[model samples]
Structure formats: structure tokens, C-alpha cells
Target: MTLVPYQGDALAHTRTWTTLHDEELRRRAVKAAGEKDTATLVSLTLAYLTQKGGSGVLTSPRTVEAYALGTRQFVEYAAANAVNLLRPGRHDAQHYINHMLAAGRKPAGVQLKVAAASCLYRALRWAGATDVDPFRDASVPKDRTPGIVKRPPYSEDDLQDVLEKANTHEKFLLFLIAHAGLRISEALALTWDDLDEQGRRLHVRSGKGRKARVVAMSTSLARAARQYRQQYGPGGPHHLGGRRATPPEHVFRYGSTFTARYHLSKAFQAAGVTFRGFHPGRKYAGTRLIQQIKDFGRVAAHLGHESVDTTRKGYAQLAADDLKGDLAGW
Candidate 1:
């Protein structure tokens, strides 16, 4: 048998292709190409991402954490049913789906799991592993009953009160999320550099689905943001520089989602207001802004929506005279 040129250079190849440790390389290559062991693939994927973090597409710390968690859950599900992912058959995929449905997991929750599995399979393929991707043919129907319910918008008065009384970071965060309709993660990931004070714009490097967009800033919000910068941002000696919190430099780093949620809840309770979810504030902002601002396209663009139809869908009902004119006609 002819010897391969890199016969003893396996370690070098592994190091070249992946950032995995020496021990990890041995662990990953232990499984044969056609093997269908779910545990091994899941573990290998986790190890691969962990070892090659910042050097691959998996750059975000939160993304790494999320993948780690999602992989653990997938492993637990597979081990309980003795299904291997490396060679997942239709039966294995169906069983996992059934398990998730029976466990009363929300559709969104199951979708996250599906997404994690898909990502892992893609990574495995990229790593030159021979495994069939189960997610390619397995997708939940859109019309199927969702595990989560759509939340309603907040009343104008109640929403305004929440904005009025919210603390520094809370107020700006709420404003950015509500008026700008920003995702919670996007709102949290913002920084001083992302904000354009002179041009009155906020740059979202990567919003949902990794899409980048520049959203216009409201005059009121711009002024508030400037004040926030002067007081808490990376500036003079009072700013605390990088010594604040984990990634303390983030615009919304003053609190976590739980903390922000609690703050909003308390504000609601104090104002005798109730909301189905935090999203209502966003709805309220959009609806009210449309009524006050004639340029629907501008409003849509400022809110980072891809089209004006989406803006109209939520705000059309809040037409200027919808309430007063309808009542008078009655």
C-alpha cells in the first residue's frame, strides 16, 4: 500500500483545519465516517465550536453559550430514546418530534432545538463528516398550532407612563425597543460607536437573522442618548471605563433581561397597567408614531422593518380618528 504524504502529520492537519486541542482531535476522529452516534456528534460539535471559538462563524459568547445549552438538551433527548444523530433516520427524527410535542414544549422551543440540530449537522458536514442532515426534510408546518400565543399591544396611556417613569438605561432601552422595534438582543448589543449622534442614526451590525440595518434615531431619543453617553459611557474618569460589568460597555448593560423585565413589571404594577408581554410597548410605539408621523416609509425604515406593509399591519388600526370618529358616528 502506498503511504499518504501526511501519514504521521494527522495532528498538523487537525490543527490546520480546526482549533481543537490534541486530545479533542483524537476524540473526534474515533468515530467512523458512517457511524450514526448522536452523542458523539453532539459532543464533537460542542468541542469543535468551543475550541475554535472566535476563529470560526461562532464568534459571539452568547452564541457559544446557547449552542452549549441546546446541544446538552439534544443529547439528553437522544440518549433517552437511544437515537444516534450521525446516522439519524426518519424514525429517529419523528420520535424526537413526538417527544417534544408530548412534553408540551412550545413550537418556538422546538424550533430552537431544530435550529440547533441543523447547525450541528451543517458543522459536521463542513468538518468532512459523513452524516445525513435530518433537518433538510424535517420542518414543522407554518399553519400548525404554535406553542406560543401572540401578545397584544399596550394601551397608549399605560405605555407612555412606563416610558416616562423608566430609569436611565431602562428608558432608553424601552425607547429603542419600542419605537425602533428592535429585538431584545439587538438592543442589548448596542454601543456608543453604534450610535451616530450627528446624523441621528443607530447602526445594528447584526439584527435578527444576522441582517444589518441603520435605523434613524428620534430627536427625543437622540437627546436622551447623548445625556446617557455623557454620564455613563466610556468617557472621563467617572465613566468607570471597562471596570463596570461583564461587557459593561454595552448600552443596555445596566441590567439583564430578567432585571429589565422586573423593572417594567414593577412600573406597570405601580401605574395599574397590565400587558400580555413586553412587546406591547413596541406595538404601542409603532401605532402611535404612525398616527403622528405621516411618512409611513420613514417610520418603517426607522424601525428597521423590511417593508411598509408590516408597519401598516400593526399601526393601521390606530388611525388618527379611529376612536373619536367611530364613537361620534355611533
Candidate 2:
């Protein structure tokens, strides 16, 4: 596959690929490497990982994407300054750490930078470099400043106003996201067969990086899905006039009322919800579940979080009474 090219550079850089044989590109990568040693390695490593998957202990797609983006920015800086990346010592890595701090990237961003460099160091070792990995002993600073926090979920009454205003398709999308906790990609990629009416749940056949997960459906959401199916059922040239011409498994379909640039935006507009797209809605529902359901394990599983700790961190909101109880114990 042809990778998209990046603009405004001395080398006219493009994304890294599995077998990119563009002479000028490789020469630019090497030239940038020779000047800004750490930067070049960081860039090349992120590119390699993005193409063939990661090399470090963690294979999570989210982690890989973070490292790729962090390193890409660092390399752009190196290319502009003409620094050689291959010969950098720990001092070079430290310099980068300082630079990120000055740029207000904080610990999480620094962690990604370190991770990108660490991945590159491993690749270089495989390519016959004898130097030590600068990131081996490196760590994110304890005093690192925090980034912007995510917003809390909407309250029940507020959510009702939005839902009440939404049209049929809009309401269906919000129902799936808010009630079911589906990622946007998962909701968009859904097919009809994945839903089992009798079973009362939907299978997220594939998720980020193609991981599979099963999600339960609410009684209300299932009803909405049925209504939408009948309204936009298999018909004309849109599904294409033929025997196998079912409205391809994709759950969301374009509506004449509003060209939904994105499912959530259209839903928000239709529903008259004032806040951001469906994430806050999902957050709201998950938080409500925490208060309404006593079982922690069930809540975590239902939300598809890796652990209960994550569920608490993202969705739990402590009431004044609960906070006072802890203070009383103290």
C-alpha cells in the first residue's frame, strides 16, 4: 500500500512502510540519522512499529499509536536542526527529556518519547549497534504536570432532554454508545449478524488493532435497533439492486435530513445534546451503573475496561456522604 507523504521538509518525508525502497527517502532518513542520532532512531523506530507492529513487551495498539505520534514530532524537530541521531549518548536523551518538559508535554508524553526511543534502540541493536539503550534506566519525572482531564458523564435528566430531541437514527446511535459503551469505530463497523435478538447482546467482532470483545445490549437499545433496521431495510441502489443486496452490515446509514459527517455529531445535533459526542454519554451511563449496580466485577466487564481500577477511575463519582465517611475514619 502507498503511504501518505508528509509535506514541507528538506527530504520530502513520507510515512514508513514494510518495504519502502524509495532511495531519496531512505537517504533522507539516513542523513537525518547521521546528524540527529537520537531523533532519527526515534522516527525510524516509530515508523517501523506502526508498519509491522511493536517490538517492546507491550503490544497494545493504543500504546503503539502513541509512541508513533510522539516520535514523529521529535524527528521533525531533529530534521529542522540537522542533528545526527545514531551517535547520541544518554545526554542526548536527557536533552530530549528537557525539551519535552519545556514544551509542556508532561510525563505521559515523555513516557511515549522514551518508549519510542527504547523501541528504536532495540531495532538498532538488531541492526548491529553496540551502544546501550538510553531509555533503559530512564523514567518519567514525579513532578511532571498533568494534561487536560476528561469531562464527567451527563446526568439522567440532562441526557433525557438530548435523547428526546434526537431523530430515529440519531437516537439509535446514542442508545448503542451510551447504553452499550461501544467505541465509535466498533459501533460504525457493526454488522447485522453480530446482533442476536434472542441472546440480547452484540459481538464487537473486531475492535482496535482487530481485537474481539463481546458487549451486552440493553432492552431499549435492542428495540431501537429493530426499528432502524425496518426503516432502512434492504431496498434500492444504495444497497445495490440484487438478491444479496442487503443494507451491508454497517449499522449507521446516511439520512436525508442531515448529512452526518460523524455518527455522534449528527446524533448530538438531532438530540439537541449540548456536550461533546457520545463518549460523555457512555461515561455518564457507566457512572450511573456504578451507583445503581453493587457488583464491581460486573460493571467492569460490562464496560469492557481492562480492570475495575480503570472503571472506578473513569466513571466513579464520590458523594459528599461517602467522602465524609472516609474523613470520619481518618
Candidate 3:
């Protein structure tokens, strides 16, 4: 709290106390809020949020993108409803949450948007854009779904069929995720130098959380890598639609992750497998490896997880029925 000269009378005797966060920085913030320049607000917020957060050298791009989209949506909503960006009405954030809920957004989706909006407002205050955070009190519905039911992993047969039907590019890409338990982002970031086919290991230089680790490759994954290299490495290419050899440095090249997903989906279609997205393949790897090894710590490390608990929370996709046989004669 600070004192400000009262704006009431021409002959006011004293100043009045105000609760504005930063009076000195409010000038530009007030101006931007008054002008409703949400684009500037969003761009600035994204830069602030994505810059080497936590223990990582860089924030995940997926996180950066989600925050960007969520922030943009909030600002756009504010602009549409004539809500002041800096000084949103006390209930405005809740109102936006209601709007999203009514629009069929999931609770998780709503939470992300609210978090992004709140982050942007805080950043605006830091950047001297605004001193008020309208989203501070806004809340979304809590999820009630059982944790075990979420993100079930794909079956081994499903992976086998996918690889059988996929072309060389798609085949090896799935091999990285399904066999090696690599995230799609990590798989897409792979280079030829990262693979040791004969040694049956893959060096994941850019694992999630910016943690680097070498994954033990399956014999199948190693064999597939060797074949992929021999077919597509510095030679006439028959796989990539005869479009010459893929770049020597890059492993899977389809322009972007989106393009990679498209081809992978096509391969799933050809194999008659359900396209439940890519992470399930990683889940499959974790579940299968844990069942085989019976050690959460080792499997979690192999999966590049920071902890066994993290592995259990996200990748423990096995049902009770699936685990029944393990204790049959114990």
C-alpha cells in the first residue's frame, strides 16, 4: 500500500492510501490496458515464461505453445467482452471459466487456460504492464476420474502391427517411441550420431525435463535402426517416396511433429490399429519393461523419468487383471 494524492477536490488537504501493486510502473501498463494491446501482452508473456525455467537450459516448446494459446484466448475474450486487461472485474476470471465450461472444454483444459491467463497478468505486472491479476481467484472444476483409467498404454500386438505396416521412415519412428519408450519430441530430435546400433543403445540428448540419458535399445529396435541406416543413409532412397536420402544428421524428417503424426496415423490406419496418439506407445514401453524387470526405478530411469513415482503416476498403465499372473504362485 502506498499514498497517492486524492483526485477528488481542487483543494484536497491530504493524500489517500492506494493498493496498486507498482505505482511507478503503472503508466505503461495503464496505457496498454486502455488500448487493449493483447498481442504485445501475449508475446511478452511467452518470452518470460519460456526462458530457461527451473533446472532446464530451456523450457519445453510444448509447454510454451500451450501457454501461448491459452494466454491469447484469455486476452481475446477480454477484448471481446470489453473487460479491461489490467483491471479485470473481480468476477471476470470466473466468468471466463464459466464460458469455457459452457463451451465444452474439459476441466484440465480450463485449468490450463486459467493458469496461462494468471501467468500473463503476473508477467504484465513484472513488465510494468499492469499491477492487477484478474485471474488470481478464478477456479475450474476439479477432475474426479480415477488416475488409473487415464492414458492406457497400447498393447504389444498393436505395436507389432504398426511396425509391419509402416514404411521405413514411419517404422523407425515408431520403433523409437514404442520400443525405446522415447517421447515423440525426443524421437523427432534424434540424429544419426545418437544411435549405437551394434551396441543396442540410443543416446537421448534432449529427453523431457532436459534430462539426458542413454536408453537400452531392444534387439528389434537396433536391427531396425541398422536397416534404416543402410537403406536411407547416404544412398539412393526407396523409402521416402524416392526423394533422395534423408539429411545425414537428422533421423526422422517430416517437416515438423505435426507432419510426423500425420504419417504415423496413416501407418496406424494401414495396420488397422487404433490411433490413440503417440504417448501411449511410451506407456506401453514402460508397462512392458516394468513387468519384465519388476523394478520401477530402473524402468523409470530407462524411460528418462526423474523418479519411480513419476513412472507410477503416468506410465503405470497395467490393470489389476494384467498383474494377477505375476503373484500366482508367490
Candidate 4:
């Protein structure tokens, strides 16, 4: 029941719809979605959420994927119960949430799906698509996962243990987060060109929520990186041999991001340390730096964080006993 001839045109069932900003097209499509079956609107609305003009912020693909997964799950649930996916009321949303909880879904998983569904509705309502925002003001429960500290940061000894056990790719990756305070995604997106002056300086191009920054490398890291360059530098097997010959290839040139995280977990297992995720590695770098320098601003700058307060609150995991001497005069 498409209001437009989308079935015969290029915008039938693809992201090509994203490029067209015709208000009439949007109005017609959304109007039909409300009156008729919303079967195709699921993908259309999900794809629309990624548009900057639609969702405000051009959401990252990873985030968009999560949104799609949750939205589709909600659509499936609505279909099973004969609930309207496009026009669900607040009670319908609450019922779906309660159903998930009763079915033994974790609190965090429920929250994620709910959040995604909310985003979907938000996108539609923004464009006057449905005038139905069922998730708005919907009751969402707090995550009651049993853990005092969600993910505990690694200690210096813990990092050393993992470093010793890690393979070449894993070792370098661990250094990026544990020593240099880079996000795992940032490290995975690294290219040979990001290193400067023989790895004495590093250009972090994949910073989260901020522009790029250049960080200076320690003597030991620089030396190790230099050695890595000699081993896998230009013309090496992982260098520039693929279809993207013009662009610099990724430093950790794995086939896909699928196997990259597995390497880190394997190292953690061998080192007998719990895999607390890659964020703990950045936490290690921040906490260790804060301990040595005793300055939140310096540590924040080193970690590429925007604020000293963020560094102090989130990353600087200094024990009160260890900081007693440093704080005595202050």
C-alpha cells in the first residue's frame, strides 16, 4: 500500500530512499505506513534513523545495526501478538518489555531493545510519520545486574601478564588501549600512516565523540613499534596488496573485525585474567597515568578525553591509601 510508486522505482526497498529528502515522498510514505501494512516501513524507518537530517546526529553504523536488530525484534513480537507495529500504544510497549523480562531476558538486554524501539518511534514521529510514539514516557527498569563494579580496571601486573601471553597482533592492540588509552575500535581502525616519526608520535584518527589528536609514545612503545614497522611495514604481506591500493591498509590487517576481539580473549585466558572488555585496558592506561603524574588534566589529555573531570571520575582508579601521601599537603 505504498502511497508512491516505490515498487517500480529505485527507492523500492533500499537505502536509496535515504538520499532523497522530498517532503512529499516522506509524507506519502509515512501516511501509507499508518493506514496500510507497515511491513516495508520497518526497514525504511530504520534506515531513516541513520540520516543526519532525520535523527539529528548521524548515528554510527554499529549503533544503527543495534537499533535495527532491536526494532526488528519488536516488530516480530508485535506480529506474533497481532499488535500494530506502527501504532503500538504505551501498554503494548510495557507488555512487550514485561514479556521479555518474564522470558528470562537480562535487564540490560531489555533496556537496549527498549532504547532501540524508542529510537525507531522517535524517528517516525520526527517526520510526522505516524503520530504514534508508544515508547515515550514508557517505564524502563534500571539494570539490576549483580555486580558492584561493572567492569574492574586492570592492574599493572594484570596488563603485564596479558601482554606476555598475547600474540603479535594482540600485543600491539593491548598496548594501544592499556598503554596509550585508545578505544579498541580506534586501535582496530589504525593504519600505518597514523604513526609519525617512527612511532614516537601517534595520530589517533578514530577518536570517539571528538576530533583527532596526536599522542606522544613512550620510549619503549616507540622502540617496539619501530621493530614492528621493520617486520610488517610497507610492502609487507599486510601492507597494500588489496583492491584499496591507493589508501593505506589497516595496521592490524585481519580479515575482519570478527576475529580481532577473539585474539584478545585468548590472551586473557592464557594469562589467567578475566576478560573485562577493552574499556578496562583504557582504564588501566588512565589509572596508571594518574598514579604516576598525580594530575587529572594531564591524564585526561593523554587519554584524549575532553574533560579532566571525566578522566578523574571515570578512569582514574587510584586507591585512597596510595594517594594519602600525595594528598597530605593539599
**Every candidate's CA RMSD:** 7.5, 6.8, 9.7, 4.9
| Clashing residue pairs for model 4 | none
**CA lDDT, every prediction?**
0.62, 0.60, 0.74, 0.69
**How well does each candidate superpose onto the true structure, as a TM-score?**
0.66, 0.70, 0.81, 0.76
| Candidates by lDDT, descending order | 3, 4, 1, 2
Tens digit of lDDT per residue, candidate 3, span 155-229?
A: 878888888898876888888888799988888788878999989998999998878999999998888898888
lDDT of 1 by residue, 118-142 (tens): 6676666656554578777776544
Clashing pairs in 3: 29-129
**lDDT, candidate 3, at 154:** 83
Clashes of 3: 1
| Model 2 C-alpha lDDT per residue in residues 206-315, reported as the tens digit of each score | 56545677888889888877776666545523343334322465555532212333644654566666656556766766776776665557777776667777666665
Over 4 Å off in model 1, which ranges?
1-43, 46-64, 126-129, 144-149, 193-200, 205-212, 226-238, 241-243, 246-269, 272-280, 287-300, 305-330
Residue 39: error of model 1 in Å? 8.8
lDDT of model number 3? 0.74
**What is candidate 4's TM-score against the reference?**
0.76
TM-score of 2: 0.70
